[model samples]
Target: MHHAMRQPLPKPTPANLRRFAETPVARKAINTIKDQIAGMRWRIQRRDGNAPAATSDVRIHILAANLDAPNPDDSFRSLTEQVIEDVLVGGWGAVEVQLTSDPQRPLLLWPVDGATIRIYAGWSGDAEEPRYAQVTPWGRHVDLRNDELVYVRLNPRSHTPFGLGRLEVAFETISWLLGAQDYAARLASNTVVQYALWLAEMPPASYDKVISWWQNEIEGTGKVPIIANLPAKPEVLRFGEGSDRDLRLEWQRFLIRIIANAFDLPPLLLGLEQDVNRSTAGPLLEEAFRTAVVPTARLYAEHITREILGRRLGWNDLEFVFEDLEIFDERAQAEIDEILLRNDVLLPDEVRLRRSLPALPGGWGGLTYTQRQMLIGGQRSATGDQ
Candidate 1:
């Protein structure tokens, strides 16, 4: 007998990962990371001094406005949300940047489906060179140059041009979870009987009568009392231990935790707070920001700066940044501010500005505590002489 070698199954693609992401726990994990990244406040700043503008260039204003509102159809926040979702599900986020003749809005950004993007071979390590193309639904390929699009990867790999998505990491787990959920749904839909009524020493006609009464009358009625005067007493026989313990819910919960871990999110955010306490909750959120939000936000900002700001527009001095990436701890920030003030690292007016407060009247607010005391002492001495 000749033995036939079996061919290996195809590896999971972005579309397969996206289909798995539609599961409840997987979707929650992806959306949690997406919200954290997309909700951040982004800005364009100069690299030389980190100022709002490097010079009196009109291009800065035009670029800022274009970034704020990519086009009339899409806002920056909405586009970012969709792009981050794509990155989380597909490991790639792409946006086609079309240059417009309008002076006010010179660039129009349209999000390209990451799943449809195909990277061509024979690509050298040139950032400005074109290497990608988009495959249309009708089987047409549209070339996307490197400078014409902003493409970001979640976890870039040297072996392959594609990145590794979080969903891909937990694909098998999510598949098992979905299967378990489907089984539970089947149980809930009365595919299996939980309890059956056994009438001992009853005629066939009487058993049929009782079953008919149950199917026709008792099934749809909401918990109404049943006063049955049957020939034999009915014995209740339970099939298994119980539905609560039989569905393997603990297994499902374990799968949810695995999916959350793959996305670098706390299980609490994915609706699993069983092990969480008050003391750990705050720290868990901070850890999430550090692990999940910061990396993705920084990657997004870097790509925007490199592709859109620097390469496309030739604005090498300007870069993109997300202002609100840090998890804001009011008490910790206040303590740091006090330490800075005591050490004369920051002036009172500078601290006020940092807190978004109006500066104090006159130049007094600019002075440190020691300087203010010395100025008051000099003023008092002059007043005594006068």
Candidate 2:
């Protein structure tokens, strides 16, 4: 007789396993932070492009190919965008690379839930190596090697591999914001100008009758006007003034600015109206990208290059470089490049390469025309022009 086959159990839901740090307030703050950072452009380059080997030069192409298709479904750009967003929101994030059976092309990156993976560091006395222990939703434990994972952390605490996110530090501010919003909503909905009925000589038993009559007559329809019979005229009393509402709004904006400061973001970038003209706005925006976006992008690039590219592929010379943030005039760079070319400080081919143009034919492109003329003269000829 054949034995009955055992059915595999389903994996546990990630939401059930761990609580996320993203509250409604935190999510709003994180989204604002991400919107500013996601627009930055970046690329990977070789450390030494002038190296003598043919295959070594083509390594950039090979690396780009691997990054172009990180997994079956996601591209490197999309994966990086998601990873950055996750890390900013949660403090630390990771992606697991499942190596193929072939030795040539080993890594196949796949997005994994960071909450499921538990990191273990080897103690000083223990001979064991540091490893990642991933517990599946179905309660299966799988150990992973360091090279098999690409991890990114921001502002990590001492003695721990995991990072401490901005959400942890800004928790109190976010809660206050939430509470302020709730109070504003309640004020808007519940506080209204109410009419009080004042009677000259009404009995206690007649109070309920008068209230019921008033409700039926005044609250029934807006089109029809009510003429109530009372001993004295009704008095109008307002619950809150317009100035109080304005103060609440101002306080909320002040709190938002505080939150922006924690993330190192300028209130102007987040669409907060300030007393700034074009002159001041330009400098503030430049400072924002320099202090906030550039540093964060560098952190991401350095970690990925060292952990994934250096260790996994053994391509230590390769690195990820974010393109310079151009908040100033583009024509200024062109003018600077022209000055350098005229002085023979940079070769024509080198200048062309920087502008993404093809090199000129033969070795003539190596020297500028000024240098060529100077060499033809046989002696150093100077007439004000370099």
Candidate 3:
């Protein structure tokens, strides 16, 4: 049913105020179309032999999830999509893997016929017991890798939990794909249309499938992808002047706007509503931001856009400021200076608690669990138990 509540939002543009026979619109307000062209131009401008090409003989895919409370299943649709097209097919671009599930359900979307391989990499809370931490190919998977190999990350006395750790591992691999010079030149040289279309063509891959695709994409390529390790273990709630600080405040405001329109919900609830739009927290008044806060904000945004807004945005009255997109960083100094020197306001990335970890997975010999834990612990027993 076509519900007529709000008009679709104007396509995000640098300029929304069109000049009438009498009114003069500034160049910045209506430049979204041109901005896209410029961005595409930028991509083309950077194209070189070191970059890498989107086309590939062997394609791969990847996916991952993250959560406040550890859940075995976290929907990895977005991550997986990048894996198939970006890394496997496009052979370029960056992807983030998280273990956070949308509403406490498992993320089941990979291991298909065309892509049968599965490479599992995650944190299971314990390297020893499945009860403390278990990895399953049964919940919702094709088990394409067909190997019962599960990577377990034991929880330490002080830790953030296994879910986040898994996310890190997932991203490390994604970076390796983006940074590999074997295709770097081609990747850097890709046209904007190529990258955008590459992004659009990616299939919604499952977690298990991503691992396989990533592995195969790099196999026998001479240079092995690196899997960077998380110095120690995950630490939850390191509240202070953290990353995404500004983004969180703005996100909180966004949540409030959402709630003001919906049922009676506090800013915090809407802010942390990815899991339950129905409760409260303890130290909710901390001035600084939290890691969970950023992920939760992303979840809320995705859910609303994917589940609610889909394609039903009001473009007439609502003029989306293209500058709002966090990733769009191609701005002129004069423009940034004008907005900042006078406005004194910060941009999204500036305010958020974002931290870019070293790109790519650990170097070759990075280890499948069978390989990583080989000598660190003990010799392999007859029962296949370390």
Q: Which of the numbered candidates is closest to the native, going by highest lDDT?
A: 1
lDDT (Cα) of model 1: 0.77
Worst 10 residues of 3 by lDDT: 54-63
Q: On residues 1-386, what C-alpha lDDT tens digit does candidate 3 reach at each position?
A: 01111324333111211111011111111121122222221011011211112111011011112211112332333322322222111112122112224433222222221112223445343424222212243555422221122111211223432212211222222222222322334323431111111223334443334445344644335466543332322222322343344123443344233422221222343333433322334333221122222222233234323321222221121111112233333355436644653343432222221121122233312223334455545555534762
The number of clashing residue pairs in each candidate reads 0, 1, 66
Q: What is the lDDT of residue 346 in candidate 1?
A: 76
Write down the lDDT of every candidate, Cα atoms only.
0.77, 0.63, 0.26
Q: What TM value does model 3 have? A: 0.16
- Per-residue lDDT tens digits of candidate 1, residues 1-386? 00111323235776677677787788888887888777776656567542222334576667778888997888898899888888888788999888888878878899888989888778785866668889887999887777887888989989998887788787877777777777777677767567898888877878877887776666656466474777787677887787577676898899888888889988899898887899999999888888988898898899988898788878788788786665257788789878988776777765554343556778666678788888889999999999
Candidates, ranked, TM-score: 1, 2, 3
In model 1, which regions exceed 4 Å deviation? Answer: 1-11, 50-59, 125-129, 194-239, 337-386
Each prediction's TM-score against the native?
Answer: 0.78, 0.75, 0.16
Error of 1 at 258 (Å): 0.6
Evaluated with TM-score, which candidate comes out highest?
A: 1
Q: How far is candidate 2 from the true structure (C-alpha RMSD, Å)?
A: 10.0
Q: 185-259, model 2: which lDDT tens digit per residue? A: 755664433346665466566677676765676654544645555554444444446556633777777877876
